[model samples]
Target: MPTAPALSILDRSRTRSSGSDADAVRATVRRAQRVEALGVDGFWVAEHHGVPGVVGSAPTVLLAAVAAATTRLRVGTAGVMLPNHRPFVVAEQVATLAALHPGRVEVGVGRSPGFTAPVRRALGAPASADADERLAELLDWLRGRGPVTLRPQVPAPPVWLLATGEGLRTAARLGLPAVVGGRLLRDVEPLRRYRREHPGGRVGLLIDVVVADDAEAARRELLPQAVALARARSRGEFGPLPTPGEAAAAVGSAGLTGRERADVERYLADAVAGTPGQVRQRLQEVLDRTGADELLVASTPYDEDVEAANDARLAALVPELVGGLRTAG
Candidate 1:
């Protein structure tokens, strides 16, 4: 296994009340450059529409910008919601991106309706359509089994499934990499099952992380975003994400008390928030339990108030996490 945490940026634009779309885009591009300068391995742009805060509706377009701006960091989608798009269109777009960047793209696929119902309806489908089948069809198109050929004919980027359980099984059967999130690691059973079933390939683990001097303060800033996201995800809101107003209403109606909300947020942070020592220990525990070949850290600095300060804190935490991985190895 590599000693360093395979770093990647999860760009959500992170709009404050005063920020505009241009401001968010500029921040994302600048942060992409900075993350590459930090020796991070790659950057993954998310795709969400209808959401005011997240400006990454077209992750490929944003990735093109990142690719033009940076020299080394790999660029691709953490995922593109396959069900919302036709297979051929997605295949061509990704192929064109690969043609431009060449071996620097990683495609992560997920089933979640990362957007709202109206958006899904606008795309000509119900949000509850079978994503697994759509993913299989997309994979088939990428593999050149479809009757229509994607032009430019770039090699297929490495495909990854952003799930566990049967999704991992699908990846194994298809001979693709699978990315397991920290939230799903309740036990080693899934990982063990994946390894046993997928002896030929590797598994990638993604953890939500925020490293700062004041853990409490970090949590305060990060919790609202995480809670909002978790609520959306749990309710199957896919495509472009819901507006903040929409998200707020959903979360508010869930009947969670202030303390319950706080507790869930903290729990979400456990995957990736704390001092260097704390993060290092937690990462090691995850590795021992999961046997993941690569670990991807999704560092969420949700709070805008401490954005600059948290950037520095994360920069300081990187080497420690890397070194600790080396030591543990």
Candidate 2:
């Protein structure tokens, strides 16, 4: 069996409908602590604007908290959506984070247009057309290649571009790592192209992970995450994650309607859920296929107890699985 790559994490700070958003934030911090102690290389939080389902709106702020709470972890945004905020603000914030955390900070940038028209309008992001320009501007600010000086003059951290569409080419041109997602699992000519263009450049794999008693059991534990995504697609609303009971009531085997059923299937298809042995096998396949240099686990469990104790479970499960693989090798 192939050994797992250096592991990392992506915490979406998904809030439960019945709990406070602060609960999610604090939970993410705790997860970071566990990730750090478990020897994960990085812990990345996301930046979503006006999305109720995700409470990690201010990634820099949350990263600062994560950094203060842990000493060794590389803290960063899975990405900051560049178009949603001013480039200057991003440059300053990242620089400040780097200054505070030193070599332990990472800078991942994304140019995703907001999820909805209202969100885009609220952020004043023009259109899909603006993404490339915004991405370029953000890069210029970070790389200091442009005329503007990054205020305070702290060294910027390693930049990772969230691989999406043409952004792959940009990351290659700049010699930055690209975080490859499962959505792009079908076609990774981009990652291949990236390595060919920038020899030996690293690419990070971001995948959904769930570890429970068994494959079916793990999938069920991850259903809330799948269901939350389905709800977003079916309703155009990204509200808090529904409780397992609530999700099962709405989209269980017999409850789903046309779009809901389709959405649920699609979301479930992207996840990797199983016992340690099963997860290890599937992740080995992913690693062989993508040849990704790093692995970033994105967990979305349904049970409130599981959600609250994710860090402990993941801390125990990941090491056991990875170690078992390595020992076998």
Candidate 3:
């Protein structure tokens, strides 16, 4: 099997109760620099709007900040929702960032469901039905195949599709690289089909991970973040996601009580939560299962203290994982 590339960090900060938005952005920038110093390959920003806990509404803006702060870490959006904005505008934004950052910019595009009903309605795109077509149009515009010219002569940034299940098939048909998360119920068959059909594209997998000295503590801290994700997905706030209690738990204690926590623990055992050694083993298992060429680690914290600890753990884990993989090879 081909050894996977070095792991990359994607900053998906859950909105904390105390920190202001500026504080969170600055903190994210600091963390980006720290991770860069530790030899991470890249950093990705997510786009989430109208969510109380998610502050990364504009990934390009955040990526620009990250670009200015760090010298070597490649920066990009894990994706920009295509259907919500004009293709020309997105092309220009991405092109401008790439020009400013030179060869260090990557553009991952997706059709997002925004965050809330009001926000989606405000954007004038309440559904993702036309996202694929919009993405295709955007690609054409970026590649200079469209009739209208995208000025400023921006070289197209490498575009990656955030795909799941049949979405992978569409990505393959378009000959684009894909970044897939584990929320889809289907096996790696989508990836296999993508490779078999396209033969020239690439695939990256995103996994929620928390590696620390205390395994149970890490899981406890990660539960709220997982729960938030579950609720968001169930409401169709984002793309498809793993059913709650299957790989994650609810964030708040609305229905889940003491007994519920135990059940959640049992349900989420296979999730990537544990000590460094155990987390590494779980990652390897995921790799074996999917044969993904790249992995994006999304680490979250239930609170400030846990966030700091998780960041430190990630700082230590990156080099160790990369070095071990290299040595083993």
Number of the predicted model whose TM-score against the real structure is largest: 2
Residue runs of model 3 more than 4 Å from their true location after superposition: 112-114, 126-129, 184-186, 230-267, 303-312, 315-329
TM-score of each model, paired residue for residue: 0.81, 0.89, 0.83
- Give, for candidate 1, the lowest lDDT window spanning 10 residues: 320-329
Measured by TM-score, how close is model 3 to the native structure?
A: 0.83
The number of the candidate with the highest lDDT is 2
Clashes of 1: 9
Question: How do the residues 1-329 of candidate 2 rate in per-residue lDDT, one tens digit apiece?
Answer: 64446677899888888778888899889878866776677899998777788889889999999999999998888888776778778888988988888899997888676566787688776565576676677678877876778876777678888887477788888778888785666576766677678776777778887867777777677777777787777677778877777777777566566787777777677777787777767776776667776777788665546754554555565543332121111
| lDDT, candidates in the order shown | 0.66, 0.75, 0.70
Once fitted onto the true fold, the runs of candidate 2 whose alpha carbons sit more than 4 angstroms away are 1-3, 126-129, 253-255, 308-329
TM-score, cand. 2: 0.89
Query: lDDT score, residue 289, model 2?
Result: 67
Clashes of each: 9, 0, 2
The regions of model 1 sitting more than 4 angstroms off are 126-129, 227-269, 302-329
Please give the lDDT score at residue 122 for candidate 2: 81
lDDT of candidate 1 over 57-151, digit per residue (tens): 77778888888898888886878887788767887888888888888977887766656678888876664668877888888777787888767
